[model samples]
Target: MKILLTAINSKFVHSNLAVRYLKAFTKDMDYDCKIREFSINDREEKILEEIIKESPNVVAFSTYIWNIEMIKRLSNLIKLVDENIEILYGGPEVSYDSQNILRELNGDYIIEGEGEKTYREFVEYKLQERSLEDIRGLYYKKDNNIFFNGKRPLMNMNEVVFPYEEDENLDNKIVYYESSRGCPFNCSYCLSSTIHGVRFLDIERVKKELSYFIKKEVRLVKFVDRTFNCNHKFTMAIWEFLINQDTKTQFHFEISADLLKDAELELLRKAPKDRFQFEVGVQTTNDEVLNRINRFVNFSDIKEKVDELLKLRNIKQHLDLIAGLPGEDYNSFKRSFNDVYSIKPEEIQLGFLKLLRGASIREEAVAYGMKFSPYPPYEILKTKDLSYEELLKLKKVEEMVDKYYNSQKFNNIINYLVKQFDNPFDFYYELGKYFDKKGYFNRNIGNSEYYKVFLDFNMEILKGDKDILNELLRFDYLNFNKKRGIPDFIGRSIKRGEEEEIKNMLRHKYSFKEYYLESFEIDIQTFLKDSIIIKKKDYYLFGYGGDIIHITEEIKEY
Candidate 1:
């Protein structure tokens, strides 16, 4: 019999680790098995045609919240083509309530949790004509009645086979690796909280697998571990190994900043710059809100640790904040935003709350007056403390944050502008309001247009000393883009004589060969037109495509 394990990812760059694991574990099985992956962006008809062409005896889908709806439709279409083919579903989205999913989706089988061992057993039983009544973690239908055989126990991490050692091609895809399974902390809003205890792979085995990835020099290896640094020793071991390797591969981890020990911090301090990126979930800074959600964290301590990490300047830090949470009104969330913003993280991801299927937040949602969409993702619309109108305002704030702050385009100007307001939140809130009024959020604007909007807003706010704002805007605009002409709103053109002088200076002092100017792909004439010259008592400098060139030294002063 032929078997096919498939997944519909949210993006094409994402690879399905679940199907790879299943394929690796059943490598020695008699049946022919293969893994096929597709993105939600693919056309439904194309996906259905591809599955029909495979003509497999069994088709198992790895389900997730992002792709559940798409999978249901695709599976129904597959059944229409060939009713004899068996259909199966697995993954966290369907694992919690297998019976309901089985009844609603009308699938032949559902593997609840820990699918490797149980799926191998089910395949064997089906191909060999053995009874599957005793198979744990298998949910099936018999005589139009659904039956669930209960969940399987979590497997020892060491028993799982390495999935990537045999694969050759991983171009333009993020390779996922997991040194451990399960999460130790119980954060109510997260699905990982439902699972208790942590299981780790043998250190030697993990090293061997990592060695394969390092040897291949994969572009990125993202750890899927729920909390990568839960075990200090395990984290240190992997970090030490990766740090010493001679490769360009970068690794990413989701860690708890407050839990980092002194040794781990010191080790990270010595690691190479840009080699690692850490994602810390700050969620919220409000203590009352944190308590209500049963999330254990010391906001002050997190800030201190994050500040230290920022000082290192080697690792990229991504701090996250959830906009809608229990007891977190707009005012309280503003405080959370300001607090996290002060840390100067490389990226501050402002996200909203999602009521996951099995998460505790969904279970207690009614008490907090949480209303959400009845579809996948189940994003919160409003709550008792925050109205739909208030949430709409925050949504605008999120858009502006993504455009200005997260884009890292106007870094220096944003820092300067925030100081003019009472706080960072006030600046973002006012900017969000302006963006909404002007309908900027409804349209897609380019980088240069964004700078124009910033300049206009600053002109209104500063009222006086417009030159300083213009100078700062010029600096920021040039710094972000390398091959773009200056926007007209920034300044007027240089005088005819000054323009001629600038052209002579560029040819005589900063020749194309001497300064490697050819690398910028800009001609001297275009550079002269776009350049902003700054004349000082001792030196004459100009900004062109983020470069500050001093031309006075080459000229003889009278």
Candidate 2:
């Protein structure tokens, strides 16, 4: 049988690890199996054309909340093109409601839970044209009736095959791997809570698989483990192995900050800069709200550990906050935002709660007066404690935070401007409101235009010094931008004559070759053309001469 496994990713940079696992596990089977990937952004007609060219007898799709709707449309289209082609659905999106989904969509089968073993067996039955009644974890339609083969028991982690093989090319793509399955905590809003216990792959097997990635020098490998640090020894072994390797591949993990102990901190401190990124889910600071969602977290402990991690100055910390929870009102969520923002991690993700399928929170949503969209992603519209209008307002705040804080382009200006408000949340909220009033949300704002818009907003609201703000804004602009021309709002301080005189003085102090090689690491002509100087308390020099920026200061009289 000709088999085609398809994955429609949310973005081009993402890979579907589930499909890869299915392919690897069924590698030894006697069938022609191939993989095809497309992003959700791809046109429906274009995707339909490509799948038709493949001409496979069976097409299996790996579904997720972000792409399930697209998959549904494509599946029906594929059937229209050739009704003989079989449609199969798998992954978290269809796993929970398998039988109903098979009946609703134009799919012949659905694989629930862990798919590797079950998929292999199902394929064997199909290749032999035998009974699929014995295949567990499979939902199939026969004689116009949908039949589920019952739930499959979890398989040993060691039995799973490595997703990435030697022949695959992973350049410019994020490789997703899981060292373990199931989460230790029962956060009711998350799908991970549906599973009971944690299961880990053998440590040696994990090391061997990771070694392959390191040898290939993959740019990024993201661990999908819900709480990576739940088992201290297992986590440390992988970290230590990566730290000792002589490769530049970066690893990302989602870990719980409150679970960090001294030993873990000591090991993380040794991690190389830019080598690791952490996602810590501090959903809310209110202990009562956490309890309502069956999430047990100590805000104080999380803050303390986060501070220690910040002190390490190596790993990039991305903290998260969920807005619409059972007991969190609009005002209460603002407090939670302020509490998390005060920690000042590298990034803050302001997310609304998602009422996902199979999560306990979805079942309890109506009890708390939670109203969510009845579709894929099922984002919360409001709860008993929050109104739809209030949630919409927070959406604006989320936009501003993403543009200013998370982008890190307006770092200097944001750091200075946020202090002027009562708290960080107020700062972002006011900025968002200003942007909305100016109708900036409707227009396409360019990268350079952000500085001007922010400047106007600051002056209008804070009535602060334009000169000081200009200097900081210019400093931020020069650090990120390479173009020599400054925005009209951020006019240069020094006259052309003084700037030339300073460049001449530098030439006399050090030869152009030596200075460019040691400091800027670019041609002297490019350095002279691109570099800009802003007069703060001192002459702060900034240049984006290479892949990295080098900022220097000249205190001497020019």
Candidate 3:
């Protein structure tokens, strides 16, 4: 019997660790098993064609919130082509409501919860013509009645197979590895909280797996652990191992900042720059909101740890906040935004709350007056504290944040604006309001247009000093890209002869041998327009990629 395990990923770069794990665990089973993966962006017809070509007797799909609708459609199409084809569904999206999924979607079977051992057993039962009633975690339809054999016990971590050994071509794609399963904290909104306890693989096993990835120099190995730093000793051991390896492979982890011990922080500080990235979920700053969601975090301690982390300037920190939640109104959310923004993380992920199935928050939605989209993500439209109108406003704010703040294109400009404005939220709110009023948010806007819009906002709305804004914009623009051509709105150009003179001076000052002149290479006209020429006591030369070199006056010791 042929069995095909598949997964529809959110992106092409994301490899489905779940499907790979399932495939690896069932390798030795008495059946033909193959793993196929496709992205949500892929056309349905193309995906259907590929699946039909496989012509497997059984097709099991790993489902998630992002690709459930697509998988359902694909499953229906597969059944239409061949009625004998058995369709099975698994993963978190269908794990909780297998019965409903089987009834509504007409799926042939679902292996709920931990599927490694259960799937092998089910496949063996089917191949050997054995009774299906004995298989645990198997929800199958027999004689027009659905039978749910109770959930299987969680498998030991050591028994779980290593998925990557068989897969080739690991370069560029994100390699997701899990050292542990489940979470320690019972955050009401999170699906990870559904699993009661945490289980870990042996440290030696984890180290061996990590060594392979490090040796291969994979682009990124993002830990799929619910809370990576839940166990301080385990986390430190892994961190120390990675640090010692000093490989090009960068590791990413979702960790609780507040839980970081002093020694752990010190160890992290010692690690190489840009070698690790930590995604800290500070969902909301309001203690009341946090408490309502059963998310216990010491905001002050988290801030303290994050501040300490920032001082090192090595590890990339991505802080997150959820917009609509119980007890968090528009004003309260603004405070949360400003509070997190103040810490100045590498990226501030402004996300909306999704009422996921089996999550405690979804059950309490009615009590909180939560109205959500009746779709896959089930994102909140409104709640008791925040209205639909207010949520829409936040949506606009999210757009602005994504375009400017999160893009890291306007780094210096954002820093300057925050200092000029009362708070970061006001800056973003005003910018979002301006974008909405001008109808900029309705369609696609390019990077150049974004710069123009910011300039317009600064000049027209804020009525800031033109010279200072221009200087700040110049600094911000050059930090990211090479000097190609300066926009007319920002500055004016110099004469051809004068431009030639400045270029010659720059060339003489920064020899091709001493400085990396290739990156600093610019046409005379482009250099004249883009370079900021400022008079500070004496005439100084400033190129886009280099520091100001004293041209007229001798350099003085500080």
* TM-scores of the models, in the order given: 0.90, 0.94, 0.91
Off by over 4 Å in 1: 165-167, 459-466, 484-487, 490-558
Which lDDT tens digits does candidate 2 get at residues 1-558?
888999999999998899899999999989999999999999999999999899999999999999999999999999999999998889999988777888899889999989998899888987985479989999999999999878999988888899887979899999999999999999999989889899999998999999998888899999999999999889889888888888899999999998888988899888889799999999999999888888777789889999999999999999999989898999999998889888888899999888888888988887899999999899999889999999988999899988888887887778768778888888888998999999999999888889898789878998986766676677567667854666777766656675566667676554433222112212222223443333323343453452322323442644
Clashing pairs in 2: none
In candidate 1, what are the lDDT values of residues 225-318, reduced to their tens digit?
A: 9899999888999899888888888899999998999999999988899889999999999988888888777799889899999999999998
What TM-score quantifies how close candidate 1 is to the native fold?
Answer: 0.90
Clashing pairs in 3: none
Q: Which rank order by lDDT, best down to worst?
A: 2, 3, 1
**Which candidate, 1 or 2, would have the higher TM-score against the true structure?**
2
Tens-digit per-residue lDDT, 351-380, candidate 3: 999999889898899999999998989899
Which residue runs does candidate 3 get wrong by more than 4 Å? 490-558
> How well does model 3 score by local distance difference test?
0.81
Ten residues in sequence with the least summed lDDT for candidate 3:
516-525
Q: Which 10 residues in a row give candidate 2 its minimum summed lDDT?
A: 515-524
lDDT of each: 0.81, 0.84, 0.81
